[model samples]
Target: MESSERQLRAQMRFFHDLVRKLAADGDPYAKVLSAPDNPYPAYEAIRARGVLYHSPLNTWVTADHELANQVLRDKRFGVRMANGDKVPEFMNFDNSMLGLDPPDHTRLRRMTVPTFNPRIVERWRGRAEAICHRLIDDILAKGGRFDLMTSFAHHLPTAVIGDLVGIPEEDREQFHLLSREITPLLDGVVTYEKSVSVHAALDGMAELFGRIVEQRRADPREDMISRMLPLVDEGSLTMAELLPLCMFLPLAGTETTVNLIGNGILALLRHPEQWRMVAEDPELAQGAVNETLRYDPPVQTYRRIAHEPVELAGVTLAVDDELAIVAAGANRDPKVFPDPERFDITRSSRNDTLAFSAGIHYCLGAPLAKFEAEVAYQTLITRLPDLRQAGPVRRRGSFIIRGLQEFPLSAG
Candidate 1:
């Protein structure tokens, strides 16, 4: 334990010093890492530098919409180094599909495609709507004021994902806590306290899911875990692979939707005109979701490494060069989105947003996340037509997984 603690402290100091060094050097991407609350200015600075800015951190960065899309879709780029090494400091999802390249990524992704495909995800709409109403019922009981994030936004995705993952209702709270603890690691920003919490959370999740795995082996159920157990027995997957896959599903599923709902509602409330449009005609809920995704995305950036030498927009990237693709910046590029800074629910070309990323690694859960947010907004506007901000909102300290930490609201 002492040795592990020392290692954790050392790692934290290293990242802190690295961030300070880069920030001092005026590295725009590093500015986004150090102070992420309003990264748009730094993104604009990167755009000012040109299509591709080489950061002191040695990664090629881009805020250009077309170039970002080209890099994400290009077969010459991948999530790993050319030598097949995983990027350091990223969440240890290396065992899961999120960290794998082709063949393995294709294999694991294919296994779960049916589960998150639009048709199957659409089947969960009633359950999602019911969950939303139930959460609002709790919010209404709070005497017209409450933290929307904890009382509603957070619970909606957690409950839905909990049910889908076959976690018992009694254990859902613990599951949510562990998932939140692990989310900060996504940004590659680590403090000593966060490091300790994340380690404990990972251990807790392993124990919790291990028990479920054994139970499903004994008594098969109609859920994601039980469905995949056959693959484990058939030599297609091992216990080593199954545990990480289980962990990845809840982590990825919950965080994305939770942030989507929170960020979307926050955007609407900040722009009352858009809020009024949705409140007056809830059919515009989908439009509200699309606009929210473009205006303030849940995920701000993703990384890709050149698997081979590639030329993009007058820049030559050598093999193994890493690029930080700023999706948030790309979503707001004027070339693709006119008046990109304005949040308009009625925008016609909102679908061009890279909010869910692009190409082979496009979010598998995008359909489910959008459906849940659409249901969430529609339900909130219909039930709490007077919903508005009740206090100052706090954004989470994660740059990669952008979201709210506290969002107080009044049902009014």
Candidate 2:
């Protein structure tokens, strides 16, 4: 089975590479879509083309804030195909709330709403702060230099989400590694190796979750999985839905929050004044988080398919027509934001950033993610007043999820 899957991924990679090469050649839209690294320039080029650019790949592209906003909220468009089918098989594993539309999406989303409520997430602030300080203490003990991505950003979210999901402490480290291995699935494209590894990692997680489910059944606790077990028994949710929903907790709570911290810190370091602003005044931490979401969001882009004939930016999208809503680009849209290229923590409208997207699909984890990131930034700036980049930062090779794979830093 593994061999067959690898063979399939190789073939997919072959075609994906061919299209990527041709796309990267002369077309800015293609380059933007195919970019392995910063796609900002290509985003600008696409914007220059028009508010809505029809790409050679037969998909609609939009960077304009208004258009992206429209596409996101319009009930005529959705994540699934016109026939109401889900996306490709490889892209569908544990998709959870991400893949559903309308009643189903609403159903699954409502079940998790209380978990991410602002009041509930606010209660996590102390926990997040404690985790942050502990990680920093360990880094401080290690001569003040560490890869922030691994030591701080990644582990912070992993640990918090592990606690939320009620995973045993002994299994948290292995689960963290598995979550990292499977994160590449969030990318727009996946290589043969990544595909195999992600599936394997997910399978391992499924096995682990299966055990947790049984354990929770035998001995219920106050954690999320334990809370949902009764729903499974009462038929409010099936075992299939419940399992994927729990799996999504890590994806929703871990990777994006990790990137939010990693990206926010990187942005502050790159802009010394901004760093000093927050470092001097810890009160500015929330604003810094908002600016970070605006300047370089963790999740860069999203796609939607037209469910029926719909007119957008003077062009009609027939059923099944896909559009790439570049949230990173939308965040930088000059029409919505003054001096969009400038990274200013003081920007009044920074809270309106599309980093968490908009409409019904607005990231369910946004509140918790914001709480985690704000606490993280405040802790780092206050604790490591002289933190600076220690080595070259390595960005994760993902077009969909924008984040660093490695970010060396000196906590001095």
Best by lDDT: 1
Off by over 4 Å in 1: 1-8, 90-94
lDDT tens digits, residue span 227-321, model 1: 88899999998788788778887788888898899999988888888888888898899998998899899989988999988988788899989
Clashing pairs in 1: none
User: lDDT per residue, candidate 2, 4-31, as tens digits?
Assistant: 7776776677757766876757677667
lDDT of 2 at 356: 87
lDDT of 1 at 207: 93
lDDT of 2: 0.83
Q: Each prediction's Cα lDDT score?
A: 0.85, 0.83
- Kindly state the number of residue pairs that clash in model 1: 0
Regions of model 2 farther than 4 Å from truth: 1-11, 90-94
